[model samples]
Target: MSRLLLLSPLLLFLGLAYLLPLSGVMLQSVTTPEPGLQNYSAALGDPLVWSVIWRTLRVCLCVTVLAVVLAYPLTLLWLKGNTATRVLVELAIMIPFWLSVLSRAFGWLSLLSNRGLINSWLQSLGIIAEPLTMVRNEFGVVIGMMHFLIPFAVFPLASAMRSVDDRVILAARGMGASRMRIFWQIFVPMTKSGIVGAALLVFVFSLGFYIVPTLLGGGRSVMIAELIYLRIFQIPNWGLAAALSALLMVSIGAFLVALIKRAGVSTT
Candidate 1:
């Protein structure tokens, strides 16, 4: 009874903040502009909707893979480095969190745009006659997302790496195992949970990304989130938007369930 009383405020917060809004969205998805599943039926039949969903999945996949690949080395450095090195690496990972997502998206825009610094430098050195189309495309969107997600991947990876017994690594070295052999045979296998956790974390977060994709993709690489925005704000299709929102929420919920299972989290 005491625990329930203690949790009442939090439960009320969740009811108000999440359950109510979600219920409203689901109800609107079916009941708005006349009742039935027509909105979902139309969304499923639309080629453009399918294209956006697939594109969103692809971008999320790219970001997950890149974040894990890049974060592995950084995590290793963080785990094994000296105090000063660890501080610098940690600062690099955490500093970006202080900035708003919109600011980071715009920052990437300045650096990746056709007339941006990178292209200007390349052009000045006569490396290319024209500016490269970096922003307003999938490449730019992937780059921005990769940068944002790598930090998320690193922390989980670091946690996993810390759990590894260093003495086992020493024993492998003592047995004349090469550094590469030990890493592949011992280190990576032991950290498999962390890798999966990081990948799932990054992928799930990537699916709902709006500002970064919208600003960087410039409509050329429109993702599901941006499409939802267009449906609601521009096209004024509330029913369709609500349907897409509900679908996206379901998909993310599935991924989160998988994440919890992978982490061996207790639901009780």
Candidate 2:
């Protein structure tokens, strides 16, 4: 009872800060637009809306995959390295966290745009007569998202990896197991929870991302969040915006539930 009472403030804060606002948004999404399912029906019927949603999902999946793949090696290096080296690598991963999203997007813009660094270097090297179309497309969005999400993916995996029993791993190695066998059978299995957690974090973060997609995607790469922004601010269609927002929430909720189930399975 005392512990429950102690946790009440934190629970109340979560309810006020997170749940209440989300519930309000959900209500607005369904309640507006003539108080019917018209908005949802429209969202369902609109191919353009579906396309944007698909693009968002595709980009998020790509980002999650890339982050996990990249973070795994980096996390292993961190685990195996000396304290100083590990700290340096961790700091390198976190440098971007301190930087603003707009700044990071602009950095990519400079690197990927025509007449930018990559193009100038390519031109100097005589690789092509003209610059490549890297920015203002799905490629740029994926790169930016991967950059933003890798650190998040790494931290969770590193934390989990740190908790793994080194003696158990040593015992496996003493039994003549190869390094690959040991990693796959022991280390990877133990860190499965962290991998799922990292993937879930990356996916959820990607789902709500707006700035990176907005800046790098140009007009061609429209995401659901960006679409909702346009509906509300650009088109002044709050009802439709609210409906889209509701759909976004539903999608995120469904993904999270699925992730939780997967994580539970891995832990068991």
Candidate 3:
């Protein structure tokens, strides 16, 4: 009873600050445009909405795959390396988090632009007659997102890998198991949960990403979050914006549910 009383303020705050606002958004999404399912209908019926949704999913898929692919090797290193080396690698992974997302996006924009570092180096070496279109496309978006998400994927996988006992691997090797076989049959399965968790986190983070995609994606590529910003601020279409936001929330919720289910997270 004492603990319950002590927790009352936190519960009240959550109800007021988080749940209330979320409830309002849901209400507005359903109610603002004539108090019916019109907005949802429009969202479902529109091809552009579907396109944005698909693009967001595609970018997220690519980012998650890239982050995991890069992180697996890094995880092994972190798990097996000496203290100093592990610290250095971990610091490198975390450096981007210290910088603002917008700042990172701009930095990538500078590097990936047609006349930027890579192109300049190529030109100096007489490797190409013209600058490559590296920025303002899907390529730029994926690169920027991968840079941001690799650390997220790495940390979880490294943690999981570190939990694995090296003696177990040694014992497996002693039993005539090859290095590749040991890794595939033992290490990979052990780290499966962590990989799933990292992929889910990276996918969810990438889904609502705005600045990197907006800056690097140009006019051709549009994400749902950016579209929501435009609708609210630029177009002043509150109803549609709220509807889009609700859809985003629903999508995120569904993804989380699917992730938890697939990862076998126990709810009880």
Model 3 lDDT per residue over 143-255, tens place: 99999889889877877787788899999999999989998999999888788888988898888889998999975688899888888889786777789998898889898
The better-scoring model by lDDT among 1 and 2 is: 1
Per-residue accuracy of model 2 over 1-268 as CA lDDT, tens digit each? 9999999999999999999987877777677756887888888899999898889989999999999989998988887989998898878897988999999999999999887899999999999998899988999999988998898999889888988999999999999999999989999999888888898988988999999999999877988889999998898877788889888878899988987787678668
Taken over the whole model, the C-alpha lDDT of each candidate is 0.94, 0.88, 0.86
Q: How close is candidate 1 to the true structure, as a TM-score?
A: 0.95
Q: Which residue pairs of candidate 3 clash?
A: none
User: RMSD for each model, in Å, please?
Assistant: 1.9, 3.1, 2.5
The 10 consecutive residues of candidate 1 with the worst lDDT sum are 259-268
Better of 2 and 3 by lDDT: 2
Top of the candidates by lDDT: 1
Q: Write the per-residue lDDT of candidate 1 for residues 29-67, one digit (tens) a residue.
A: 999899999999999999999999999999999999998
Q: What is the lDDT of residue 92 in candidate 1?
A: 91
Model 1, stretches more than 4 Å misplaced? 1-6, 265-268
